[model samples]
Target: MWRFLSPQILFGADSTEYLERFEKRRAVIVTDEVIKNLDYVSDVSKHLENSETVTIRAREPCIDDALELAEEMREIEPEVIIALGGGSVIDVAKAGRILMEAEIEPEEITPFTSLEEYGFRGKTSLIAIPTTSGTGSEATWAIVLKNIKERRKVIMAHERAMPEIAIVDPAFVYSMPDHLVISGGFDALSHAVEAFLSSFSNPFSDSLALNSLRLILDNFIMSYGGDRDAREKMHISATMAGIAFSNSQVGVVHALAHAAGALLGIPHGLAVGAFLNPVLEFYAERGVERLGEMNRNLGLNILREIERIEAELRLFEYIPVSEIESHRSEIAERAMEDSCIVTGPFVPEREDLETVIERVVRRCMREES
Candidate 1:
């Protein structure tokens, strides 16, 4: 048996206003230092009566950062916890919320973890308000944190870790930077593509994945060019892709991205953008029949569209090709150990992963030269 899970989502122009429903309740806004200063925080805080903000100081949070936030949450004991930032901030909140209710190690938050066994009773409601259009952290159960000592990403998931509500307000994303626009677009696109190709994909996830992929392919360029309507569409599509992957899982692109992010300190979305096309090419070459099926169903060549976008946007221009080449074997080995690696349409050998890394490096070099 399979299950699909999602937060109660409030989307579009004034979705943050939904927080007004909890005006009198004790609310704690968990956000990063940078986002806490943004109008989005004020936008959310204005809708609530009793609320306070807790800033996650780290730019790219680690497990210790979540634990620190957890201690603060324990003191506040707020009725509601609103994660008000991008993926990193939301991930910290998810882990912090769990840690607040139960004294458990960060690594204990595996997919099979039983929070109830550890005295977790879900005391505080989590509301994820994503400030960016990517990562879709508001709608997903997954949590990603850096294991600083090991130089690997700690991927965690639990049904209870999912936020109780997801507010996808276009207002929050309107002022997003150009780099973020490119990164988030690619991140969402990769999510949609990988979800459709995941071994765990089902009809429900397939529908969401296909629709999101189409919307992203259609609107991403327009969104980058500052078309408000296109931005709104892309924002919605990112969440759809998140939900799709949350149910169906992602594959090697994510695995590679996660590994690179953990090892090289490359930002997750940029790493994802760099690896996405190359990994897809690897899948196609390996005769992953699902790629052909997905393209046929879309009535367009998804790969070609992705290539066009990459070229138009100069998407891989920031990739550290020399660094990647130097660390190619380590990236492949690390990716092979990722939980996401096994969920692809076909599990690849370590050698296959190396080839994909080589592909990414060559593509980066070609773009540069």
Candidate 2:
């Protein structure tokens, strides 16, 4: 038995115009301060002419920021909530909308909590517009936030938190640099790979994950090279990857990422990407033959993922195991209790986790001749 989340996605350059397609009365725009100053927000607002649009600014490092955004929504009472940035922005919108409708506090929001309890008091829908091409919050039901009280990254997901609509306009991606583009692509890649390998994985999401991995492998370079066509392909692929993992959940790569994001002030994508191949190598050594099967099923050479990264993206080259050993235990300890950890195909005991972490980080490490 499996469930999936798929939002109405509009992609490509100028696709942001899809915002105009909605017959909304009033809407709140949830985004970061940086986006508010960009010309893009103005363009999005232009489409919502007849409707009153409010911008909610809550950026990184602020987990409870969603509450503040919700406070504003209480007064604005918009007919819709449009998430207008990356994962954090979308999460803020999802969490904010919930609080606005449910009139609840931040502490009460948890995966076990039923969203039906909120009842969408404003009758507002949600539209997710991803400025960055990763995270795929637009396509998933998971909403992650920083939890300052507990000092961890909260996975506050609800089926209802899934966006009703997702707009994936590549025009919004022109501002991203090679690093952001690669980071975002890796975020999606990690999602698909980890999800496909997770204990909870089912055929439904496996298909999405397989295709997503193939697409990233095919176009990551072209997209990173700033090719408009390839970039468009990536824009769509990221969403597909989002849908895949959102349904199946993810694994150790995500476990480390969430912990790093919560503790070390790293970007979400970087946290995941840095740990991805390492965890995979670890899984491969631990009775995870499925890694090879997944590669074969996708018609790809499993070993080539590393080559693809080096040949396509170039430079980031692998790091040495010894170097990564320094951070292994700390990374594993911080990753405890992560939902991803619970769902991994092979959940490592703390001792095993230490070994997996060391071995993986070692495999991806660069050896200087």
Candidate 3:
């Protein structure tokens, strides 16, 4: 059976106001200290003044604090859960909520269990307001976290974890620094590319993935260069890509990033971008037919299909990165086990991952230096 999941999205300025309408006696705001300072958090708190609000200080979501937050929720008795930060905070919210509702260990919250059977009382509303328009956390059913004990990243994904509401306000986008803009664009790029080439991708998701990919390619550079119009398009595309990949799932780039992040705490965008081009070429063999279909939709010549996409997305970067080698072995092993790896048309084995890491390391260093 096929599943399609999406939150009821609220996009544009002041969408954070939806928090006030939350029908609950008490609420918990799961987020980081950084986001708490933003206007988004202040506005959400202001709106929900009638409802008791508690904040979980999850700086990076997957840290050891999640378990404590999970336990705290039981005492807080929050009827509603609102995620008001980036991917990290959103993930912590998901884990904490699931832990409370399921009354299970954090690691046991997997696809096999039926969470709805746990019977959360009331609407148990989940509202996600993304300060950054990437990771598709506002739109997707994916949850990523670092299992600090096991020293690995875990994904607790299910259709129901999809937020009841997704607030994608452009006003928040203006608050981003230049590094965040560049990094966020890369995250969205990986989502579009991985989903577009996913083995499980069907006609429905292919259309969304392709359109989002085009939008990112057309807008990322311009948006990063400070064009509001371009930034707006990219903001919209980030949600679109989230919806697409949520249906089809991401591939190698994500697999590598997940592994690298859990082990070395490398930033998601940089880790994903470091290996994107190599995996793109590797997946190209299985990706060509699907990519050709996208080219057909764009009315482009098939001969230069992926070439056009490369130019449009500026997909290749030969950065002379020296740090990747430090954790190379561990990263290789973890990437091999990532669930997203199997979804690639050409799934790389351990040897292949190692080889790709080597090439990416050498190439990125050359490009950056």
Candidate 4:
């Protein structure tokens, strides 16, 4: 048996206005310093005039951060919680909401774990307002947090972790920096690709993935070049891809990216962007049948399109080959332990992961040379 999950999604230029329609008292806005500086926190706060704002660090969130936010939430006791930043902010808010109601460790919030059994009632409603068009944290049950002590990412998922509402307002993404546009677009592309390739994919996820992949491919470059229409389409596609992956699953791309990002202190989207094509190539080398299915469905060679897109964007230039080479073994080891690894078309052994990482490093080195 399988189930698909999505938040009540409000999308478009002024979707933030939807918040004003609600009659909730005591709302709390959780965001990062960067977004707060952008005045987006104030924009969201305007909808909830009586809300409290909590600004966390603008870096990848950690387990301690979630606990700290949870403590803050407990004090505020908000009827509504709005996460108004990128993936890190949304994830922190999700984990914080759960931690506020229940005393479980952030790492312990897995797919099979029952939060309700641990006194987690849906008392506080979560609304995820993403200021970036990537990660799809607003639409997914997944939560990625850095384990500072372990030097790895903690991939957490629970059915209840999905937000009550997802505000995909294009206005929020309009002023996104160019680097974020490139990296986040690649992250969305990876999600659509990996979701289609996942062993857990269903008919629902397959349709979403295909359309999202098409939307992203059609608009990513234009979006990066500051086309407003393309940017809006990219914004919606990101959420669609997020929904697709959340229902199905992601694969080795996410596994390796999570490991690399946590260990190398790379941004989540940038790591995913760098590793996406390499992992796809690995799957192709192994004769994964799903790639053919995706190709036929899209009426084009998906891998070749990805290659063209990556080349057009000069994505390989962003990652330093030396960093990857120096940390290959650790990345592979950590990737093997990632929960995302098992859901791929085939489960890879540690050596298989190492081989992919090595290939990625070699490819980047060749490009640099």
Best by lDDT: 1
Q: What is the C-alpha RMSD of each candidate to the true structure, in Å?
A: 0.9, 2.8, 3.2, 1.2
Ranking by TM-score: 1, 4, 2, 3
Using lDDT as the yardstick, the better of models 1 and 3 is: 1
Cα lDDT tens digits, model 4, 1-369, are: 887899999999889999996545789999999998898877787777679899899888898889999999999899999999998899999999999998787778998998988889989999999989889999999998888998888889998899989999999888799889988999999999999999999999999999999999999999988899999999999999999999999999999998888888878777888888788888888899999889998899887898788888888888866888899999998888888989999999899888888888887777777
TM-score of each: 0.98, 0.90, 0.88, 0.97
Candidate 1 stretches with Cα past 4 Å from truth are: none
Q: What digit string (tens of lDDT, one per residue) describes model 1 on residues 213-309?
A: 9999999999999899999999999999999999999999999999888888888888999998888888788889999999999999888999999
lDDT values for all models: 0.90, 0.75, 0.73, 0.90
Show where candidate 2 strays beyond 4 Å.
51-58, 105-107, 118-122, 310-327, 360-369
Q: TM-score for model 4?
A: 0.97
Query: Taking the tens digit of each residue's C-alpha lDDT, what string does model 2 give over 120-147?
Result: 5537789999888778989888878887
User: Between 3 and 4, whose lDDT is larger?
Assistant: 4
Global lDDT of model 2? 0.75
Itemize residue pairs with steric clashes in candidate 4: none
